[model samples]
Target: MKRFSFIALAKLPIGLQWAVLAGGGGLAGYALHQTGLPAALLLGPLAVAICMGVAGTRIRVPRLMFRSGQGIVGLMVAKSVTLGVLLALSEDWYLMLLVTAITLLISAGVGLGLACFSSIPADASAWGTAPGAASAMIAMAEENGSDGRLVACMQYVRVVCVVMLGAWISHLFVGAGDTHLPPIAAELPFTWIGLGMSLAIAFLGALSGNLLPAGALLTTVILGSALQLTGWLDITLNGTLVTLAYGVIGSYIGLRFDRATVKHVARLIPVIVAANVVLILLCSALAWPLSYLFGKDFLSVFLATSPGGLDAMAIIAVETGSDASFVVALQTLRLIGVVLTGSFCAHLIMKWNARVSR
Candidate 1:
């Protein structure tokens, strides 16, 4: 029997190399899942990709792969958005809007402070800290003449921090230890037609997302929800597909963390981490009052208010048996709000930076 050789694989074409990396990442993610760590699939692939990236691996995940992953996650999230959830959200529209406004302000303030104090540009910092979809923000930052690479670093670092901290907090407060994982497709009542329709929606959503702001994931979620909420379709994705989505997303993000970025932001890492911690604490505090007003537990509100990846937060909500619908709704609302207003806010910060520099 011949032994497998990574060295030989590395000599292959970049596309094939990436495929191999993805397979290895999926296996690693599965192994990590066995350890009961929250978001293990995401964390494992992310860690592996980061290590490979830092080691100077030239394999790259295409933009399509990332967008598809976002679509899959978006569809998964949309499953939580029922008519009941919509009605509840309508009743608290004012409160949810207020919370979204406050969170945006906090993000803007942190970004401005970073721009004023650090060497990072104002536009990059603003979009990086906007609390919007990480991929969307990065793209917007680049389009607006900011350093997309640095913005990606800031956004993803905060994402990692928010996810890990949110998981720990949820575990501590909600005691998710006793809760079993949700059943996969085999146990669920799902049809091939439903799966086919869902895939069609995801593909069309990805194409439409090119025209919409933060479109890829948001579009998928909206389309999926529209179908499900209308009782026209019910789609249940299998555990394997969800895990694959996680692997692609995690690997895509992790591969962006190369040596040059790490070295460039060495001094700024501490400041960025500090800013993220302060933002989370401030948001958590603000969530307390809303929890009472909404008749939800503190943990649920905190996760809802958290500036993290939407899919990761939603997953935590489901696993912890918290209000998944509420969490997903608020997160989705805030994400859209931020994406819509991000450009104007970034302009303001840039102007402010100019004035302060004078």
Candidate 2:
């Protein structure tokens, strides 16, 4: 097989190169989807992009593409935010706070464990193991002068593991039968005006996110939820658009896992994997009591508490007839909490490391 070279790829127009990469990514995603893996669309494209990147293809996705992807995912999440879900959350506000705090502890503990066992820096491990938005964590790690590539690898690896494990648990333990809920966003009737308005909000949200922490995705999520909550707009994102968003986001993250990055984190791989498994199991155990207290099924509670990407967990929630709103709501709350406290927490980790070393 002829290997793709960066120099040869650079000779082509950037647009053409991107189009070719996108096509390849799509085909790879399709193949993976056929294999019945959870999050095949995302994992598939991501795997292919990583290989392409390692092979020296200089096809870089623009920042705008990822932001747009976030906007689309945010809009999809908004579909689950109904008045009933809001009321459920309001009634259980204290419990939500408690769960959020517990999740933070779990993340911090995992970060500390990784730092102690691996050669990665404490601050880097802290941000890397945070069960927050992958993009947000990576960006913060870079801003904090930590190794962004390593952080990205850790975050995404956890996501993939959490997703696959979540799916298995949903199927084996929860018995996620056929979805009973009506197709909220996926089946909604589409209108050009609605799409145009949604796009405008997404674009504005992306621009505003520049000034806010974890702003791009969270801002769009807030905007979309508010619009639906107030009955001011019915945001119906098309399936094709949502899939495109997933593909782009997956490709962007996947390309970061080039050969050099893999080599850099080689020794820490086993420790990272172990920590992820431990975190997932711990969170699931915590979910059991909460499930009884909340009068919800264990599966829904577990999905809500599981430390995975918001979009990935939400997808599992939808597919399994779990409480999509609850899952997304809890995940969103935790994401916000993580992003807000990420810096302070990282500082604490670094300080502790310094003191212990001394």
Highest lDDT model number: 1
Off by over 4 Å in 2: 1-20, 32-38, 170-186, 354-358
* Model 2 lDDT per residue over 161-228, tens place: 88768766765754423432224555668889888988887787777666765466668878898997
Poorest 10 consecutive residues of model 2 by lDDT?
174-183
Instruction: Evaluate all candidate structures by whole-model CA lDDT and list the values in order.
Output: 0.78, 0.76
Per-residue error for 178 in candidate 1, Å, reads 4.1
RMSD in order of candidates: 3.5, 3.5
Estimate the overall C-alpha local distance difference test score of candidate 2: 0.76
Compared with the true structure, model 1 gives a TM-score of 0.87
Clashing pairs in 1: none
- The top-ranked prediction according to TM-score is 1
- Per residue, candidate 1 scores C-alpha lDDT tens digits across 156-261 of 8888888778867866675534433442355458778877887787777767767865466778877888888889878667777777777887888888877678
Q: What is the TM-score of each candidate against the true structure?
A: 0.87, 0.84
